[model samples]
Target: MPVAEPPAQPPTTRTTPISPSTPASPVRAAVVGTGGIVTGSHLPALRELHGRVRLVAAVDTDPARLTAFRDLAGDDVHGYGDLDEMLAAERPDLVLLGTPPALHAVQATAALRAGAWVLCEKPLCLSLAEYDAIAAAEGTEEGGTGGPYASVVFQHRYGSGAVHARELLRSGELGRPLVAHCQTTWYRDRAYYSVPWRGRWATEGGGPTMGHGIHQMDLLLHLLGDWTEVRAMAGRLVHDVESEDVSTALVQFADGTMATVVNSVLSPDEVSRIRIDCADATVELTHLYGHSNDDWAYTPAVHARDDERRTAHWRTPAADVPSSHAAQLDGFLDAMEKGVRPPGSGTEARRTLEFLAALYKSAFTGRPVGAGEIGPDDPYYHAMHGNHPDWAPKEQ
Candidate 1:
């Protein structure tokens, strides 16, 4: 048997599957790594979804942070100094990961093997090897059949505008994808990396490409479908951090369309944006971090008809929700009850990770990297630095 010319991504779009509800009550949820993201996003979301979810436990190495969170969460939410203790005692239905990049794979897999659904933040482990392990541990059943599952927090996809855009493209309203652009350029000062983990291959992973721009690029893949190849370049251009402060890549999609990807933390003014040109119109979404309905726009092709009708069609979608972890968390919980893997779970979510790996592999090797090129045996597969053994950040 021969491999297809360019591998095709599974058309695993979000679908509602009727599932047998388990345990009858709101999902027993636990959160690990009680850092800024959890306190800022997921905890609040859980609070809002109070009727459908419950917070049972919290875990972190820092007792003081845990105490602060406990006070905010009230007396009922228990804080554990050790993750295993929390897992063994609570056996939560779901575990949300807000830990650093280095700890994601081990912690996420532990939760999954113990039979809890895992929701982790971006970068999703340091390399392809870790990603494969997490992917395998997610199990076969949608809701895991009493086992475990995992999902990365590509929260932007759950917004009302994003959901609406997906609807338009799937319905053929936007037409076939042709050209696109994705940019995640923001600023991070030297003080940001003063923490031990912010800028290293073994810890922080790749800089802007892995840590920052991943969300927008994932959104690009969300809209454009799978990419076939990437011709890219990266550098530790500005910041003295161990990873690239800036990087750029040109991506080729399996759909025969292409895109320009830019991820950087050097820009004085920051913006995250994605623009897709389809047969009928050009669709765009822009914001610094997350976006609401107000941040999206559509312009119909001049040669095409339905300008006024298109305006009405675009307005048809309800723009009630903004892009945030809360939105994706709601979807994750809903999917768990339906006994199906949530959006951004298993193989479905890792397309972005694979693309992420290819981008870095291309930059490090000074050539184009294809979808099937980087594998388990490749050096880049094991570590983000790959064979660039002597590479170092300036005056760190």
Candidate 2:
């Protein structure tokens, strides 16, 4: 994988005029931290929103990266080196926090406090403390007449296939889930970890687990509901880093369901897969490089439910599930417009982050770390303060 460093300072502002064909009321969204994934994943997704979302401003430490964003976003896309300054100046309807996972809490809190609806990138945060802090900053009750909104970016959950899968589970088509399996495999070359923050404990956080596995884990938690406990192990088997390059966990959900997850950055080819075993049958969904629930295969010993009723419940067509990022983005805007709750709020994001933190604690202490074990006072809470808990290095 090729890793390029972001440039420094804000570039010239740019804007592309909205036409009559565009949405009647466009939501102005400012993007903070236009480096790495922000450029690759977020920018493309934002573009797909068409007129509903306008790129009004951007904040980043790198000037060249800001210029690149401006070039693609348009002339009206204001650039700022300081996030607070940009928020005060542009006063965008929404703010997208594209910084590293470790910084998610602070950035998200600031954005919300500044009265801009925020859409934070995935993993919610890197540590449990960060999760708690963000959660504490949230206001679920109508935001007190006029207040900033908040939503996390778990695009995979918003997909048509994922939604359909959830409906099937709810409909008892798969019975009660007894087990689940998740695999998140991708290759990250040495060059990919060459960035200043990459593979570092103080900045990038964990390697594959936090950086890549989080997406799959988010899906797992969403599908399985709450977890009771987890036993896990992690090791830096391939990548040169302070964090694990490969990790696995044994997760037990509150419903007495069990699951196993394997996340790695050493696989030659990328694959994201999940399998759920219910009492009456099994439902499996698999895809490489992305998620598509329409391709899922539901194998039941027999169609326990009425065929007509099951068919009628299918909300998504058989076609490929579109990008969940777009749906998630639209969801946030809708929440803002309707004065209701966003689909992926910071409080919801806290659960996933807490789960990840517990996994780390369990792996390090060689004991099961329950949900409440990691709280605001723990030293490793809120992203381990960008520290790598003591772990033995693999033998050379």
Candidate 3:
């Protein structure tokens, strides 16, 4: 709270600037996969970043997708069928990984070793062992300062509303966060799993808990800090997938706070929500995929003097900005240029993964799981389902 602010920085925010380059050359940027997220999000965000980033190369196994990427990226961009070939031919300053869960670690580690900052999508890796491998390649300060490293994509935490709330909690304005609720319940038809990697633990990690609700739960961890323990149950429910269609957990925080977390893909009427009950007020954010100022609400406690005053305190920036891959990509690029690890860097990303591992362990073993309970020695750490053959049906 006492940190000094940088000049010309955004209101109430801190940023580090880097040494000036020739000013003509932009940061070299490339993409590793031509999946939906990459086409729909990453490419658009990179376009938004314009002259600050130069489009370099793109990699994809599918010739049709690679041709599409080249068309969008331009004729100057090199297209490659292999990741190693692309990295070797063009040593980009930044590499965006939109590959599947199983390939993220290997791709990211290769990029980091190639001396480029890395940005990978959600569910970073399948296991902590893989996470550690990425971490080793990413050994550096946050925001790419000491050197380049891999960071996960969890952009909701970067929105103005979420950021403002974080400041309020940090300054004790909202009082200590107590009981809370987080829900990530959305519907995914059986056809969605037709893509081989969608439901299997080996390819996509766990189901809704690991893949879908992780964004909301990660925001939960960002706001409330460390969780001490978790009791949870995950079930296949109605989905024909190999992983749970729904999961629920009762979580305990280090500060004695508690929260009920629900992750699901079976809810007909879908929404992503989080309500934090602070001693002084209750702050809530409700939105489907991404959020803007309109998605946030604040309700003060009965003892509060005036609702107007609380609104004044909780007012986000006048500008409306939705949380998205573009916003996080901007932040990651800024951090990379400044020689910092960037938002969603390995450590910050690891915290969320650790919590997930704990949840999966608790659900699989039918017992309460502690924060560090599932490590290299734990079976659940390697295989999310552990040895519970009865827990899920064979992947169809």
Candidate 4:
């Protein structure tokens, strides 16, 4: 498909499935990662849900971090050094996968098989086959009875501007989307990479694209739909670790829309932005410093209709939304009650994992990777062969 310029305004928007004010019933939950993000994002979001959810237990390899959560949450909170032991005893309704990227698939599959709902952090897994396994293992039904639901963390979609943007697309106000450009640049100091798994391909997956840019990718796919092919290049240009610090990709979606994805972990300052061009108009938003709550710029494209005519156009207004992580969990709880699929089911996350796998394949073989080409029966299934991304020294 030929690539065309994005429309001068935002694409039409779509609304999320969850309701805003409906109170949720408390669901027993277990958290696995005691890392910074768990505190900065997920844990705080969970806390906000309050009576709707319970912090039954938490697990971490580090005894100190485990104790920290135990103290903050209170003494009755069960603390375990191992997830397996915790699952066996706690028997919680949910498990939060906060561990490194590589451990996500293995840990999530185990939790699902044990009949516990799962909320795994982004960049779901390192390989397509692993993603397939997670999808296959999801749900507790007859043919595949007694499994738990799984969802990947994509909180940005629940942001106010993002929700408004999606609503516009669904309302048919922006016309058809034809193009999207995404840029994700974040600064990472030596201290940041000091963690054992930060930049390693074996553990953290690839650098910024998988780690930092994953959210952007999710937003892009969520708005513009699936990609059919991708051509990308990745290299290590900063930090000292096993994965590339910068990467870029050319993406072609099934609807014939095209995109450019630029990501890096070497910037002195951070920025996340997406520019979408649609048949009706163009729209762009710049998010400086990664937080969606504030510090984001939204520019609607100028249209042929001026002043009065444009004013008559159905204007999509931005409204506040909860953290995407919380929204996802809330959706899961609702689904469990209604017996419906969650907003982001395990199958849905498989699309993102497929994109990641294709990305690595494209980067490694110096070729374009097509969607669905890496099937379950492919020899690369379960394949984990990429070299540790060079986290030190500049290279392209």
TM-score of each: 0.91, 0.86, 0.91, 0.84
Task: Give the distance in Å from residue 147's predicted Cα in candidate 3 to where it truly belongs.
Answer: 1.7
Residue-pair clashes per candidate = 3, 15, 11, 28
Task: Tell me the TM-score of model 2.
Answer: 0.86
**lDDT by residue for model 3 (232-326), tens:** 98888787777888999999999988999999998999999999999988989999999998898888888774767565777667888789888
Writing each residue's lDDT as its tens digit, candidate 2 over 306-376 gives 56555444444565656457777876766666555677664456677777777777777788877767765
lDDT of 1 by residue, 109-166 (tens): 8887767888898877988899889877765653444335688999888789998888
> For all the candidates, what are their Cα RMSDs to the real structure?
9.0, 5.8, 8.3, 10.9
TM-score of 3: 0.91
What is the clash tally of candidate 4? 28
Q: Which portions of model 3 miss their true places by more than 4 Å?
A: 1-23, 141-145, 305-307, 387-390, 393-396
For candidate 4, lDDT tens digit of each residue in 1-396? Answer: 111122234221111221222346477778888877776667876787766677877888888887886777767677787777777776667788888887898888878766677888877677777777787777644432233677888877765667767766666667777888998988888898988877776787667877888888887888777789999887776565667778889999988889999888888777888888877677676775344434333344566346456533434344555345776666667665554456666556777777877777787678999998887665434543343243245653
Ranking of all candidate structures by their lDDT, best first: 3, 1, 2, 4
The model with the greatest TM-score is 3
Better model by TM-score, 3 or 4? 3
Instruction: Give the number of the best model, judged by lDDT.
Output: 3
